[model samples]
Target: MVAEEKTEGQAAPELAAETAGRRMVVLEDFKPVAFLDDDDRASAVRRYSTLFVVDGRTRKGGLGRVLYAENAWGDRLAVKVLTAEEGADLTEEEQQALASRREAAFRREYESSRLLTGIAGFPTLFGQGRIDGQPALIMEWVEGQTLEEARRRLSVDDDGRLSPLVAAAIGRDLFDLLSRMELVDGGLVHRDISPSNVMIRTQRASVEEQAAQGKFDLVLVDFGSTVLPARASSLTVRYGAPQGATPDYAAPEMLTADVARVADMRKSPAVDVYAAASVVYLLLCGRPPFQLGGSSTGGEGAEVASDYLRKTTELPLPVRAAHGESADVTVALDREGEAVAAVRKALADERLSPSNQDLKEALVCVDKRVGEVVLAALEPDQRHRPSAAEMREGLAGFVEAYPANVVAALQGEPLFQDWSFDERRKAGGFEARRRAGARLARWAAVVVALGLGCAAAALCSGVRVTAVGSLPCSLEWGFPLVAALALAPAAAGYLVRWRGGRKRSGLVRGSVALAVVAVAVEAFVLSATVDPAAMKGLLGAAPLACSSAAWCGMVLEYSMSAPSAWATAKRPAQGVSGKGGSV
Candidate 1:
């Protein structure tokens, strides 16, 4: 019986080992199925039974269909498939060329996304395979609204414009992502970076919760038209073709006929920079830099594109009318017309002789420095435009230099609002100073109480003085100086409270200055009042009183200002915690 029980125990261990080994084998064999042909659909499903199509056609457009799917583990993914039926009306040669372009675009997108994997602000590519004889790329599903949708949802101002702070933040994040992309393999230009391609991932919660959650992140997507170093020539070679650019956001060089075959135009990072500026402009105003008036079809479409191309090539970039401009003045420019001819001419002349003041006038609502950077990027001459790195630096500087609370308020972002409030509290403006003043008042009262206590002690001790130097003196004579010394900090505190412009350091300096003056005055008063017999003691007491007053003043100042100092020291740690805890 004992032997049989031992054998059963040993068999239990062996069974457990067998189960774990089988689990490992199953995990190792797991592979994502690929649907290569229409006929292979059923086999693909059988192989990838764990992956279920949530929505077969989530979105269908001229490009193809976007299929939303999820695996058994509940991990979601998006698959872009180019169906053959999309371009069936075309000739065989046209069909072949179209297929070639589609495949190249899909492969390029996959490669670009793969290269940019692990980047915070770029999408991740999963894998690629053929779906029903057509190429398809699978990418990690990003959950967020596009910048275009977000912008549309924003509450616009009376002038039909988004807040400048919101626009600047968007520009800052977009350029930062572009800068990161450029860091890879010398540089990578996102040939298409429009509003629709940028996604904003923010928490869907109440303002307070959102602020506490602090999750406002931007991601760049759709790299189908990315220009790598090796593919730079492809842009020039494509020439009159669409070049995969929206007419509204395309650079002047991209639209100019003279630069159609220019290799320099294709090689520069200025193309992406120009598109970024255009996106910023769109964010600031409700319209693009060059608004396409008519539908993109037939004669009207050709006319509209031609007109936009001509304006982009010839005319200076137009600014939206200031918020309170008269209806007549606003209506003067056709959406497609050289409507703001005078303003355009002025801007063009300013561009020729650029000045800080002119740039300020050209773009209202946005910071003048940001306007200068954008305008420089939009320069008609591709050679003159700033590099992507330079533009990114400019935008970053603008974001950093602006007041955090103001920017947060304009953005209407809860997390930023909370951060802004904390920053403002740390900065210590008028309200902070007022609070410091109240604390100072309480400190002054305590100092006064101590001084009175010291005077009572002196009286009780019966300390007396007869004569010092050439003057006679008594305990009463020293009392006034003692009282003055004790009250000095209160006076300084009052001055700080009333003056309103001085900082904590300034208050400290003021207190020290008052101490010095009080010491000098005490010396003169003692010299004038005390006789030679009492001079030594009186003189000794004068220095003590002055030093005590100075020390008291410093203590009061520090006490009043310590909260701000403590807040500043603690802020970075708090921020780190907030970020870590946030979504």
Candidate 2:
């Protein structure tokens, strides 16, 4: 029998007698829940026979235990349960406060998941229920390694860092996801957006197929610390605020004690924006922006957290105080002081700042625009950081400006070089400029060669000695031979360079035609007033000289420009596949 739906006023169903005291319950007859789809509801019913815990006692932020389990049908799931046992040892008041906070956080997560249903890159929610008096949430199993793991595997160097292009791509996807989430619910804030919470799933299909499916390879997970601005005010006032963000990834505002009172802290998309930029920074540099003095791992967790919090809140001090002209200085500073001053100066300089320097060195192979966008997003002040939409647009612009082949190479795709030469053209990128410069130089050389040929021909043929009236020497066949010698090389060079090309053939034909017209004009004038033999020789020699010079111009142009074209054409073949593994 299909289970009846519960009204808003009704309480959640209680466990059966046999499952009453157990932390994990296997319902005897699963009922259809409003939150779950028909297929999942049916699957839950058929597979509700048993729930075996595969991993034991996985805890996050000290709030609850995450139990990894598989149902009877072998479908894996993650069940988060907030138990009262955590505060069992505490006094009445402390226990009550803790319980209230946990309940509020659990409810906030459940509601956010329900509202975020059908959103791509978000885990699907099955249902919510009570398990042994504790609130339990069952979420669909997302199969993939966390971005943290992916980052480790994709690290390019000894320092474990991501390439600039890869980092930008990941950042773009993350911001796009945040933008969509904000649009869906204006008040939604993903309080925790760290590397461990982002899943990087690899798809079997090609990139085009994945785009067609409207699915992204990156997925955001673990919304346990999500907050809704409208509901957070009441929840915080009643249960005290929930502090569950990763210290290294938390925004400065979030770390402050007055976070509860700060209106911007509660609902600002800037919170997620800050954390997302931190994630990208971590990927690009292999460490958080503010690295603790000591080790990040081991028993120094509290120390590392404290150090990170302090750095984010305060500006670092310089090595030495500013010098005063009137101050009595008998004691000179030591070598350490000088070194400190240098360090301070370097830090103050934008070009030499640790983050900028790191990005500059690491992204030498990437476009400069991409590095600028990433660094802008990493600005400590939230006001200075780009909005999620703006960040996405900046990265998208980089992708659009470059060719698909270049992008594919940056992404570490294998078939990148197999693309056609035309596909490698980038509108505003290096290759485009090179092509433009080459064309201009080629044309300039042709013009210069043609002009020189015309001048030489006119002088050698002795066509005229006067400025106005035509004057001619005795008819001579030697002038024709001289013209042929000067023009033939140019014509031959043009033919060789532009062989099998229509444009080359057109240029050659045009030059020959122009030469013929000049000869005919000269012959008409000279024949009317001078020797017909000399006019004929001048005509034949002038055309030959011009044609030869045009061909030589083609040779000069080719010599000057062909190297760059060959270099650009050969770049695609040295694909970036060997740099990083397949995308």
Best by lDDT: 2
| lDDT per residue as tens, model 1, 357-440 | 333333333344455556666766665565665565556544443333222223333322212322333353654676678567
Give the Cα error of residue 149 in candidate 1, in Å: 0.5
Per-residue lDDT tens digits for candidate 2, residues 6-117, read 3322343432322322233443333333546767766555554345554443434224666665664777776677755343346788777767866887787788877787
Model 2's alpha-carbon lDDT is: 0.53
Clashing pairs in 2: 487-548, 490-551, 490-552, 491-551
RMSD (CA, Å), candidate 1 to true, equals: 22.2
Report residue 111 deviation for candidate 2 (angstroms). 0.5
TM-score of 1: 0.51
Worst 10 residues of 1 by lDDT: 7-16
RMSD of each: 22.2, 21.5
